[model samples]
Target: MQKQREVGNRVFVTGIGLISALGNNVAENHSSLAAGKDGITKAVHFESLYTETLPFGEVKLSNDELKALLHLENEFGYTRTCLLAVKAFEEAVNDSGLSAEELSSFDTALISASTVGGMCLTDQLYDDANMKFEGSEYLEAYGCAAHTMRLIEKYKINGFTDTINTACSSSANAIMMGARLIKAGRAKRVIVGGVDALAKYTVNGFNALKILSEFPCKPFDENRDGLNLGEAGAYLVLESEEVSVGKRKYAEIAGFGNSNDAHHPSAMSDDAVGAIISMKTAIESAGIDATKIDYINTHGTGTPNNDRVELFGISQIFEKVPPFSSTKSYTGHTLGASGAVEAIFSILSIQYSEIYPSLHIETNMEGFDAAPITEFQSDVSVNYVLSNSFGFGGNCTSLVIGRVN
Candidate 1:
């Protein structure tokens, strides 16, 4: 075991909120994970023409269903992306026991991330563009930052607010930024995470990349072809040690690292230099040895390139790699929301002392000696979980989440 580091001030994960294909909230998601049940399958809620051809990790609810659940007025302009974000954010705020006044305080900050934003309505956007008379209701909500901006205004959050667009690493950076704000005394509390709704735009984009799997993805498997796109929203409430007193703290933000390989726009280098640096930096920042990590939440997207390169990075970081798996097997690759969604899973691993499994490995990956945990593990006593998120343009990030004593 590695000696744990002593620190002056600590950031604590006080609350978590998540909605994915796996479940509607944290409890539901945990149940599904414990059963080793995968939520990925043929798309039911997504509206792509490839709906029957390509598998997806799609939320079961439709836009109208989500609106009904959220109880919005008929004429409300909330896009599907914003609706998903508000659902998770509301749950996180309620879980943290924050009142309306507390939410709007100047000391409270909000950091949310998303890539699809309002592009879920691509058809409507195109039609509106061609029409000269009336503009679409989604015109203002059609950017990468639209979801976060809507959330900010919805909750009347008055403190610092920002949006990130580093592809898959967006929400990990959001959580990291939230921790820094608290540590630097810039805010007493911060709500950070990400959301991405399945859209024709995103589906077609990934299809064009030739990385969309026809069947359920097999992450880290030799025959892994590509990834299944997923949609989800996840958020975590981080409070300084002083403010977190008497709260239901889940874990500590022990360490985080961000790096960009700058190697390619769509693929990582063979050695995964950015990924290796990210994990190493995170471990160093956590004041622990590389071997001390108990498990890893790998950024295994199941694509031929991603799985191999990520495994290479893991081999470089640990002489004997820890028991790790890609939860994306269950939720699929959630793009911008992956980091925050997987972070919640990491915190759950600590809280429950269990490690969830990576679904469907027909054969071991070639040239890789280590394999993902294929079955759910219980009573494992996980203390440290290193969650990795690497995105397009070689942007990589890792977060070290530790059990709170």
Candidate 2:
């Protein structure tokens, strides 16, 4: 057993919100995950040459529908990415019972993450850049920080606000940053997560990489071929122990670790150096033995390289690995949104004492000595969970979430 060490002020997850192919809100997503439902389907809202061919974990709502739902129908310059973030952000603040005054207080902060951002308007951006359009409403919304800026303005946030873009690890880093702020006494509460919407840019890019699966992804399977791109937005409200005293906490943000291997642009090292370091550091910071982890929400992108290297990293950490599964099989790979998506899934495991299976897996990868949980399990002991998010350029992050006792 590893020696326990105190980190800092404890951070608790007071609320969560999400919108993905699985569902529109936290409750719906929880129901889908509990039932082992698969959300990947052929793209309906996104227009692309591969729309009918490659499957994606796309939210069911269209741009107009989202606008109507958000009551921003007449508004301009709100991209799909911004709309999604607003939806999830609203839910998170409501769930946390944050008031307008509290939200605008100097003790509150907003840290968001996104990769697609307004780039989801790839065609509009290109047309506007080429001066094909006289005036474009989306010209100011083309950057990755566009969504963050929108949130800051919408909520009248006055405290520290920042945006992170570490590829797939973006949201995980956002969560880590939020926790750090609370621990450092910079803020009493932090709203953190990420959002990304499907665009022709990412679709064409992944297709070019030859990593788009025609069918639903089968993560960690020996026969796993590639990943199905996904789009989603999710957020979690983290509050300091003092502020969260009267609130309902789903879990504790026990610890988090991040590292960059810089091994490859989009591939982790074969030795899993980044993964090993992040996971180990998270466990150590949490002051828990690696064996204390009851479940792991792996960053299983259904790619051959990711699955193999992640398993290698796990093997190097624990003498006996914990039971783990990939919820990406449910939501696909939501890119920047994946880290927060899986973090919420990890909290669900702790809250419900249940394990959601990695769906569509056929054969376990040979020589791994570890296979993902293949069926829905209930009444399981889920005290601690490790959620992983590894992204392009070797960015890897892990968060240790523990049950609120």
lDDT of each: 0.90, 0.93
Give the per-residue lDDT of model 2 (tens digit) for 9-75: 8999998999999999999999999888889998889988898788999999999999999999899
lDDT of 2 at 267: 94
Against the correct fold, how does model 1 do in TM-score?
0.97
Give per-model TM-scores: 0.97, 0.99
RMSD of 2: 0.9
TM-score, model 2 to reference = 0.99
Considering only N, C-alpha and C atoms within 3 Å, which residue pairs clash in candidate 2?
A: none
lDDT of 2 at 132: 94
